[model samples]
Target: MAVLHPRVAPRRSTTRATTWWGKAWVRAVEEAAFSESDLVTARTLARGGHVGQITTRPGGFFASVEDQHGLWTVDGAIPELDETGTETVVEAVAAEAGRIAALLGGDLPHDLVEHTDEAGVELLPFGSELAATCTCEAWAEPCVHALAVLQQLAWLIEADPMVLLQLRGLAREDLLGRLHARRESPVSDDERDLDAAVEAALYAARLLDDPLS
Candidate 1:
């Protein structure tokens, strides 16, 4: 799997999301907020171009961030979907072949976003499900540095929607392989054969544990 190296441009005064998926992802991170101060700090840090050495894994994203608050002591992590959750995601994708094609093409189709929501498949974190954690001194999350890293993530996904899938729980190739299996034998019924769907997705989901995948 290729590691997505985002061209974190400088002078990001504020976060922007033009695409539906990008908007949803940014909204989720903002929604997990405790105060506006965090957002402001994150924006400031991002503009100053302090976040760096960013890396993504199946389970989450991690990076080295810097700011006045922490000198040579900055790190953050954004966890993604879990194994059990991946099965549901696979099943949902199985029922929607067009969605797979769109993802394979690097487009996060609006219809697929709706389907994922309808099926309760969290390709990104929502509300209190999780928040970006950091090694900074801040007691709250989406801490300035962490938020900066997340903001960069927004840019990354905007460029390539498949990165969202990578964050969720599977690498593009592995997820594609599983999806190919689904195409060969479409899921008969999501509810009745949920077990089978999960089983089919198990191998790919397990690989999600691989760091920097």
Candidate 2:
């Protein structure tokens, strides 16, 4: 579980989503909203400091928010990556050795997400993948309060893309550890055989040249 301290409200000066991943997160949640007004109100609440401290667990985020209807508890849920999905994502990251370094440097490479998508694993929440419920008495599953939490979370994602991975159930340390282990693991028998064959061929060529010399 990761806890994020409250951010100073945007106060309508700057955009809420400062990064591409953060924008993608906002788009996902906004697409799930039942009404545009809900999104607008939620954005206002989030930017106005209506959302409180946020706690992010494996599958979701929890926070307190207030609006005209008063204070309410909001829980936002994003599906956790299954074991296969997690492995797929790790493989995608490992495909590009620098991806882990980029992530450690506070950058989320878009191609990494694209690679995961091609492998049928979504690193970002989409449509039904994002769900929420607010304590407020609203018919919508994700009421304004819930949307507010989602909005605030986008800001957090902008600051640290690791939050998105954590939401998908893998912490930064765990992901790095996995990548490091994968890199350090011994080569497969097939790879070893290929290497041996190439070495043998090179040695034969060198021997032939030595005789010519």
Candidate 3:
């Protein structure tokens, strides 16, 4: 579990996502409209630094937020990738060594999320794919508190792309482990060895006297 506090609490006028991926998350929230008023309240709560500790789980995440009534707890869910989907994730990660290296270094490339399509997986939420529940008595499908949590979660993913995949049901450690395994697979090793031998042969051939010439 990790915790994120708003570096600068949001303001009513702060109406944009800091990262492109973060913008996508904000768009998803906008798609599920209840009342614009509720949205305003949510963003206000976010910018005011009223949100609390956020904890991650297998298929979702949770956090608390303070509203006029009291402190409210919220639960967020993201659809998990299945076994076949997991295979796609592994294949994509294996295809790009730099992706894993960046993740290992705690940086996620801005384009990393785009590779999910090649893997036939969806790391980011689609339309109403992100769902939220709150203990607060706001009857909107996604109450104000829920939106606050989503906003914070988006910021979390911007800092670490691993969090996005984790919501898709792939743990960071497990995903990295699988990527490493594929990178070290026998096929890749054989290819590397063959390339090395070819390069060596060429280098040696070049050194020979120009008898053929």
Candidate 4:
């Protein structure tokens, strides 16, 4: 014979719902193009927390979270991946965004915020948009769901943060740094010689047109 208590089942369900990883997975799938489910699988990674607020701006979107660490922007795009890996997926997205920016010949949209004290590590757009902010000292960094989202982002960043960057039309490389590097590697002396030859011809014309002559 078996006996089941009426309250026991609901409590178990509630417990499962509130578990750190459980909540995170729920939040993560909710952000993506996937349906909610009880099972945790490759498609159902965890999200750290809920989105606090989201506002659409003229060209893009703006979001805010209450996590202790801020976002950090890196200096360049991530390298390509070997297969259809998560990292590869993110880098592909970023590369597309950069291509779009280049086609438009306009400034790519981007923002860099310090979500944490770590160097070159950032909260990233996916994490920022999906994980809501919190002022509490839960020490989860983000809440459970946020932690899940962060885990997913970790996977994503391991492959490519540039995918996040591309969404904003900014690549991982700094525009100024690229410009500086270009300046430092200008055309060689052979090109300068060609320019001097052209300048000499122009000067000869100027001499021929002297007023005294």
Candidate 5:
């Protein structure tokens, strides 16, 4: 079973909320909660970058984000496979997500800018078919609303890394296909015999433990 960490609530602030971005973030969160397929997508897109398209109008900013089956946050960071070499995928995605969070929090290192196609830009995969892009334009990298969405995503990611993988175009089916192909490949007779023997031994062991044995 997976253990979930308890979330620490944010400290309340009493200062007058007058910043334009701040207000926009608040509105974005509220609208996202009602409109998003899930909390993850709502939060990530709310953080604000280029994960999708953002259209600004006289009324306000309208964002059109790709929906990855409604999963969000760090969960979006998880890949679908758990085979060897897949850890690299998870780490890369996490590193990217972390960079985005750091930029948003004003803690990003200057040297890291080169990794991104554009300076201070962060792109996060939402799922196998979707992603969220964050451009560090404001003092708050993603702004407050975007940060709020990210906070939620972090929690989800910590819980399950698969969400990130699916966002990066690698799904469970992809992993299984790779595994099946590897197993079916031609091999020496000795190697094949050894493999068969191992399977037979495992089956015999299971039979021994069975109540019907």
Candidate 6:
């Protein structure tokens, strides 16, 4: 599990998610929300520092949020991929050297997601696929508190797409382990060389970007 401190308020902006995957997360919850007013209020709560520390783990996240009523606990979950689904996603990632390189470099490859989706493993949640329950007595399936937590979650996702992968059931280490095992399986020397080259390129790019590091 990882803990995320409350976000410092940012300058006014209409955009909540800057990354493609982060935007997809927000869209999922927005489509599930029944009340537009709640969404508006939730956005305000999320941006104004009404939300407290958030805790995340495989398949779920929770946080404390304050509204007009009071402070409330919000727990949200996106269903984890089953064992078969996990393997399918892993296989998809392992098959593409670029996907592994991108992930190692803290980037999510769009084509990797497309491949997984084509393989029937929806890496990103959709609609009510993301569900939440709040301690607030609100009748809405996802009260303002829950929505606020989710909106904050999108901010975290923007910084690290791996958050989505973990929420979907595969942690970073576990995913990498599976990929390593697949690579260790019977394969041609050329394939190994290609994987090594991709990793070398990623490392070189990082050094060039921040020589001080």
TM-score of each: 0.72, 0.82, 0.77, 0.23, 0.28, 0.84
Maximum-lDDT candidate = 6
Candidate 6 lDDT by residue in tens digits, 3-67: 45455464366637877888888998799787899899889888887888888788888888887
What TM-score would you give candidate 6 relative to the actual structure? Answer: 0.84
Per-residue lDDT tens digits for candidate 2, residues 109-182, read: 99999999998998988867888888888999788888888888888788778888999998766675665555
* Candidates arranged by lDDT, highest first: 6, 2, 3, 1, 5, 4
Candidate 2 lDDT for residue 25: 89
Backbone-clash count (model 2): 0
Model 2, residue 21: displacement in angstroms? Answer: 1.7
Greater-lDDT candidate between 2 and 6: 6
Question: What tens digits encode model 3's per-residue C-alpha lDDT throughout 41-79?
Answer: 877887787888778766888888987789988988888
RMSD of each: 7.0, 12.5, 11.6, 20.6, 16.0, 4.2
> Please, what's the RMSD in Å of model 5?
16.0
Error of 2 at 205 (Å): 49
Find the candidate with the highest TM-score and give its number.
6
Residues forming the 10-long window of minimal summed lDDT in candidate 3: 193-202
Give the clash count for each candidate: 0, 0, 1, 32, 26, 0
Which whole-number lDDT from 0 to 100 does residue 182 have in model 3?
Answer: 46
Off by over 4 Å in 6: 1-11, 185-190, 193-213
Clashing pairs in 3: 10-47
Model 3 — TM-score against the truth? 0.77
How many times do residue backbones clash in model 4? 32
